[model samples]
Target: MKSLQLLSFLLLSYIIIPANTDGGKKKEALESQSQHTRTKKDQQNFATKFRLYTDATKEDCQIFYNQLETLDKCSFNASLPLVIIVHGWSVDGILEGWIWKMAAALKSQRKQINVIVADWLVSAHQHYPIAVQNTRYIGQEIADFLEWLEESIQFSRSNAHLIGYSLGAHVSGFAGSFISGTNKIGRITGLDAAGPLFEGMSPTDRLSPDDANFVDAIHTFTKQHMGLSVGIKQPVAHFDFYPNGGTFQPGCHIMHVYNHIAEYGITGIAQTVKCAHERSVHLFIDSLLHNDKQSTAYWCNDIHTFNKGMCLSCRKNRCNTLGYNIREERLPKSRRLFLKTRARMPFKVYHYQFKIHFINEIPGKRIEPTFTMSLTGTKEDAKNLPITLAESINGNKTYSFLITLDTDIGEVIMIKLKWEGTAVWENLWDTVQIIMPWTKGTRRPGLIVKTIKVKAGETQQKATFCSQSIDNLHLYPAQEKTFVRCEDRFQGQNRK
Candidate 1:
């Protein structure tokens, strides 16, 4: 009985521990190692892991592509749209979290998609630079497989979309370049393409717009670490979206670190460090799930201007969505688009640009005042969003503040405005105020409201909000009415 108990313990231990680090985490292998592992006795000679899943229902009917397949079980349905997903570096090239999630998201939207997962787990296990080198060889192998499919099964590369993350992005790009002509790849979405070894490399050596007809890239981590970053900062694609300034993503902080710790103990640190790096995947997922709530990113010179609200205008073709369903044809040439986002899931935000032109009663050095405002829609309300000057309020020019509301507030119905401080502190550099003496002797140092122009970025909705109360009230931090919304085009307010 004790011997049997020992045998049971061994069996349970083998079952509980993953065969490899990322192994068995997926429901079904893109190419099942149930038949053979890439690093096994026979596959020791192999350089790549290429597998096709044309139909999700047919889990047993996987079409594994070997360089030596004579069009036997390796045939694919040429009519369906093809999406090839490639992963970055890992010890075992087993499919990780995003791989399965993205596949599920894609399959959810479309009826038929030939989603092939490129698994190069064995070749991907080396040091960063070494694995970076191997991506080229792996890409070539992928290209060879595509060529084989095209020739034998009449597969069209025009219907192909390669979605690659980190180093896998480079692999996709290399593959795109390898297979030439009018029958080239349709699109490539690079999710935070690896920044270390392939960042500044030649376009031929890495993912580039030239590789595919339409290339959209999401760069979530690009902050320099010594001489390296986790994702490429360059606008390599025709449409490169740098969500949340494109460096340190919002939710990648101590809370996520704690969550990771709770999930996997000390080993969760691996994911914690890559929170920002891995955000691109989640952003893409959000785009798929919520098409109606799809957020638009603006084409801007810098994040500062974008945050300031100068870049919120959807003039001509200035903005684009940052996900899988991004308009394949609309956005032109190349743009490093910028946008603000929420820290958590369903990470869409409603963008608002407030343009306020201040009229001063006493004009001696216009003190830019601190202000807070609230918005009340039909269903819900947003409270106390700080309104700031986009730039130095020169004379009576309009100042813009680009702000975002995370929740759906229906149609904005009311807006409440409040002003603070005696002399409006303009800049951090200009004002170093510990305390301010009360407005000295009847100067009446306050602002006279002239025009308020507001635009909601999502709806292209325009409305002007003006205070009916004494046009220039004392800068007393609280307005009698806190919510201002329009009944028709421009008229609604709430008091007390």
Candidate 2:
């Protein structure tokens, strides 16, 4: 009975507070209407609802409290940590989707901690634009609740964590911003924050590093392909993770209409876009569940450089683990970090950086050729993984590529580099193309790779491979395997 009364009081308190407006109903109506028209600050809806859950499928942990007094009676320990899960723009609010799966994962991961799921169905049920405006109000209300918790129950704000998806990510930011005192919350995890109107908003307006002590964000779907990208591509957090270049996820692409319908079902037809966007949430959850198969991302200027083997060095807190095990202490304030993950669960894979330099020049005119390689490491051997030449296989300018080797080949002792076809046209054509000007030969000819330098992304070790003396792989044009063993170490001094 007391819980019911407090909920009613809390619900009533959330009524939209205008940011200092005129008294008359005429002025209020005009102000309300104008908010829907003008910029961000004009938004007035301040009310929000909060629901607490401690179990996977039930509200059963008996923690259902939006009011201060009920919080005391609820199944939560003030001494333990608090995690608030906030959902974003939807007609159903926290009725289904990420919030449910995330809440269950959190409960399973940390049974002792308090997990509260914020539900503001009334405001969220509106159209897209209206739902966007509601984020501010919802954010502040959650903030106000945290402040009350600090005052009434002596709850430590630093012990609280906010994990939000899309617009809710901004809401988490708002809560962190509004929570009183200089000390902010422990952390804020953004699962693909909304990309729409919040894109260019100020630090106070959307999710920013200022919102928390350590803010981490994941970008699963940033740019729009078929449907619009609800998530932004920008780096709003201290550590922003761009998985698979932050554009397209591997398995999210389903071509056929009926096949997609049959798989996702009619109700889940929107999975086309949501699947990639929602992948961030699952990635985070996977990190919590499977610590053994944790994801790793490197420190690079951008995804392009990350794709190349250039920025594989983890110097001065450069690289970081993806998801729940994310160690902010081991990571510097990088604007954009890049990583690659598998299509399904257990998304961990080994990262390798191969740096190759071609000694014998293959004329001018740039052309990317395909080469197959074999690496005989200390423990095992990785053979025939196709390597695409980034630049023309010529000169001393070292070209690099970041590739994932599923099994750890351990310390790479011997490396064999060979072409699938006789790249004779490459050696003959680049010079001929320059002379002829309008040359039309289309074969990627061969070149002598004197010695190759390789760096392991995981181990940070470097190795050099030289051509085998008796059985040079280059001699056999389209032959079988090449035996460029560790013993075949032809130092660059011999070639030079």
Alpha-carbon RMSD, each predicted model? 10.7, 9.8
TM-score on alpha carbons, each prediction: 0.79, 0.79
TM-score of 1: 0.79
Q: 133-168 in candidate 2: lDDT tens per residue?
A: 667667767776777678778888889999998878
Off by over 4 Å in 1: 1-46, 54-62, 66-75, 91-93, 330-332, 360-368, 390-395, 420-443, 470-475, 480-496
Error of 2 at 174 (Å): 0.8
Query: Which of the numbered candidates is closest to the native, going by highest lDDT?
Result: 1
Give lDDT for model 2: 0.69
lDDT of 1 by residue, 411-434 (tens): 776777777543333332123222
Cα lDDT listed for each candidate: 0.70, 0.69
Q: Give the Å shift of residue 254 in candidate 2.
A: 4.1
Question: Given candidate 1, what's the lDDT at residue 352?
Answer: 83
Q: RMSD of candidate 1 to the true fold?
A: 10.7
